[model samples]
Structure formats: structure tokens, C-alpha cells
Target: MDSLSLIELFLSALRFAAPLILAAVAGLYSERSGVIQIALEGFMLFGAFVGATSAHILGDGVAGLFMASGFGMIVGMFYGVLVLKLKADQIVAGTAINMLAWGGIPVVSKMLFDVTSNTPALEASERLPNWVPIVVALTVVAVTYVLIQKTSFGLWLTVAGEKPEALRAAGVSPAGVRWIALMISGGVAALGGALLSISLASSYTRNMTAGRGFMALAALILGKWKPIPACIACLLFGVCEVAQLKLQGVMIPGFGVVPVQLVQILPYAITMFLLAGVVGESRAPAKLGQS
Candidate 1:
């Protein structure tokens, strides 16, 4: 309604978009390197739980963030071994990873804190500054752009996904390239997940991600897998989320009041529309998901 309100709304949108941007870029790294990463949701959930639990134990949020990244990488490496070494179906492996996170976090939480869902609330000093995640997300975007467009490793990644045999002929192991890519992906997505607990919320709650990982996938598709465009798509989805929050309970001249459930579906609804419109035109790497 006013300039101040608009600015606040924009800030809120940025905050909401940070995790999506992080995870979308992370997914880009994996998919662009010929590894499908449907397990982003799982990676993020693990990070959230680990980040919260570690921070609570160590009394330090930064330490928790590192722990989250470490665990995420471990899981990512496991995923790589399953898909690349054992030749497991990438989609199936990723789905299993997601299911693992859904079930595992609670079990671990119960073991550690005697709770099966959430960790204790963190103090302000124990949480990340609000600016930290926003800055980190943007930095990752710039770095990803450089990594993909201005580096030899980037070239190798492209070849690994589009023509793995070419990379192998060049004396590079395409599997190695993919393994590294997935590791980076997991670490980045873990940062996004840590931000959920240490920056956005004070504690890690069960299923708090609430499909943001899938939304990030949609953003990745909408952006055509490019870093800058994916960030823009994330912002767009963030706008949808903020609109959902802002428009709920508002009176309409002819519609009375907006339904909260419908408002809540704004981001997801937009994602479905964008995916449907682009799926036919979008093209993935030639060798993506190939063993």
C-alpha cells in the first residue's frame, strides 16, 4: 500500500527466496554434471536437523552450520556411490534419500534430545544474522555463474553431462566430475537448510521445509538451469509465498475474504503452471541421469 510497506514486503520476499535460491543452484550443479538430484529435500532436511542439534549442543550456530554441511556431503557422497558406482536408478535413489530424511531426523532427534520432532529454541546469539543467508545465497549465485561460464572445471562438467565419453576420452573421469558436483550440491543445499533453522526459525521442526525443495526444482526448471535465471525464478516464487501470507483474510469487493488454503497454495500452484508451460520446451543435458 505504501512505500515502506512495499520495502518491508520486498525484504520478506528476499528472506523467503534465499533458501530456494541456494537449493536451486545446488540442484543445478548436480543436474548439470549429469547427476539427477531429486534428493535435495532429503539433504536439506538432514541439514536442518543436524544444524539445530549441533548448535544446541555446542552453543554455537556457526558450528551447527558446518556440521550440517558435513553431514550433507556425507549423504551426497553416499548418493553418488549408489547412483554412479552401483548404477542404482538416480530417481529411485534420490527418492529413497528423501524418504530417509523424512524418517531418520525424527529417530535421531528422539535419541539425542528425547524429542521426536523439534530441537530446542535457539537464542539470538546462537542463530545466524538475517543478512547472512541473504548474502550467502547471492554470493553462491555469482560464484556459480563464474564456475559454470568461466572455468575449465565448468567445461568438464558440461561435457560430463552432455557427452561423458568425450570427458573420458580427454583422460578425465566423468564419474569423478559428477561426484564432486554432487558434493558441492549437498553442501550448498545444506546451507539453505541450516538457514531455515538458524536464521528463519529458532528451532528445527518436523517437515519444516514443506516442499521448498520441490519448489527449488521447479525454479531450476523455470530458469532453464542457469544460475542468474534460477535466482530470478526463486524471487518470483518468493513473491508468490509472500503474497500468500499477505493476502490471507483480506476482504475483496466481490469475493468477501480470500481462503487461507487457496492463498497457501499460491507458490505451489504457480510452480505447476510454470512447469507445465515450460516442460515441453525445456531440454536437459543429453546424458543426464545416465550411469
Candidate 2:
């Protein structure tokens, strides 16, 4: 490929990585606060629907993004109540949230747009520029780094995850810290989905996230719950996705013509492969998943 082609590819990689970065960071706060973050996929799907609907009605992409965050916070609060107050199993609660997104969206869409599948096509004006997501992704990463490394609250978060009893002795309510973390996780994760529908695709479609939420979770594990390292992992995954896209229908020297289906599976396969290798060695927070 030429230099320009390489530049374009790099830019594309950044674009694709943007949402994954946000989602990973979202998981970062949740898991770091001792919550298992399986609800990310559901949160993203909810955000995508809310964002697409808000953008379509309001005709402003930025406004739509904010709306999605708001809804995401609500979803987070709901999740928090289930797990924290009701003492529901975190993984099962998260799965229920995902199922809610899958079933509830079509009903809402039908009521609003008379379409049970997707929202109307968005105009160019409603879509965000490619650079916006990259900037957003990096800014979130920097902010997360500072929050995790520099703030008193960040320390509280770490303690809450690693030792809730210690946090209690420090006179901080671990549940309170976790509440804030879950809210942030929902909001940021929703931004990931909002970007997908409003910036990348211009409208919401059913199941549009396509497991990027889970991919972000893997990135978080690979990063061992650190902001900068997690961001790097997300970028690497983004590059893999871009490579898969670029290699579709291409002939290899010895492999002959690879099937498009096989090429499509490459990124996901890489995710599972990397996770299998790394997760066993990576240490999680001490108090993670405790009810």
C-alpha cells in the first residue's frame, strides 16, 4: 500500500477503535469498583437506540450524544439497584439487561417510528465527523488515567474493588463509590453505542454493536484494568478489525482466495485467542463480584 493508503488505514483504525476505547474505559470503572461489567453490551445497545432516536427527532448529533449518556446513566442506576440493593447476581442481571435491550427496543421503535426494526435514515448533517470519535476516545482515556491515578476518589475506587472492608474502615461507603462508578460506566459505555449509530452508521439498527461490547471487555482484561494499557489494547483490536475489512475478497500468495466469512471472523478469533492466553495471568480486584 502507498503512504496515503497507510495513512487512511491508520485513520480508519482510530475511528473503529474509538467506541471500543470508550466501552473498555466504561468497563474499567465498573470492574475497578468491584462490579463485574457484563451489562456493557446492553448499555451500548440502549445508548445506540436512544441516540439515534434523539438525533432523528432533534436533528443535532451532539445533542443526541448527550441524550444517550443520560439514558445510559438511567440504565446504570437500574442495574445498580438490581445488583446492589436487590442482591441479584451480577452476571445474571447483566444478561437480563442485554435481553431487555434486544426485546424492548423493537417495541419502542414501533411506537415511535412505526418501524419495528430500525429508525429512519439519518442525513449527513446528523452524523458526526470521523475525527470526533477519536478525539472523544483519547480525551476519555486521559481523563480516566487521571481519575484512576491521581484522585482520592480513584483511590477509593481501587480499595472498593480490592477490599471493601478496608474502604469501610476508611469511612467511605463502598456502595456509594460503586454507585458512582456504575453510573459512569453506563454513561461512557452508552457513548460507545451512540458513536456507532450517530457517527459511524448515521442511524440505529437492531444489534448494531455486534459484540463490540464484549470485545471491549476482553480489552479491559488484556489491559489488566489500567487506562492507558486498556486504550492500547483497544487500538490493537481496532487495527485487527480494519485489517479484516481491508482483506475481504483478496487473494493470498499461497492460501488462495480466503472466504469473506473467514476474514470476518478474524478479529473475533483474535480477541478470544488473546483473552485465552492472558486472562489466567492477569489478577482481578480482590473483592470483585461479591454481593
lDDT of 1 by residue, 67-186 (tens): 998988998899988998899999999999999999989998899889998999998889988787888889999999999999999999889999999899999999999999999989
In model 1, the number of clashes is 0
Question: lDDT tens digits, residues 1-291, model 2?
Answer: 799988998888989999899999999999999999999999999999999999999999999899999999999999999999998999999999999999999999999999988999888999898898999999999999999899999999999999899889989999999999999999999999999999988899999998999999999999999999999999998898888887888899999887999988887998989888987788998889994
Best by the lDDT measure: 2
For residue 135, model 1's alpha carbon misses the true position, in angstroms, by 0.3
TM-scores across all candidates? 0.97, 0.97
What is the lDDT for 200 in model 1? 88
| Model 2 lowest lDDT segment of ten | 272-281
C-alpha positional error of residue 25 in candidate 1 after TM-score superposition, expressed in Å: 0.8
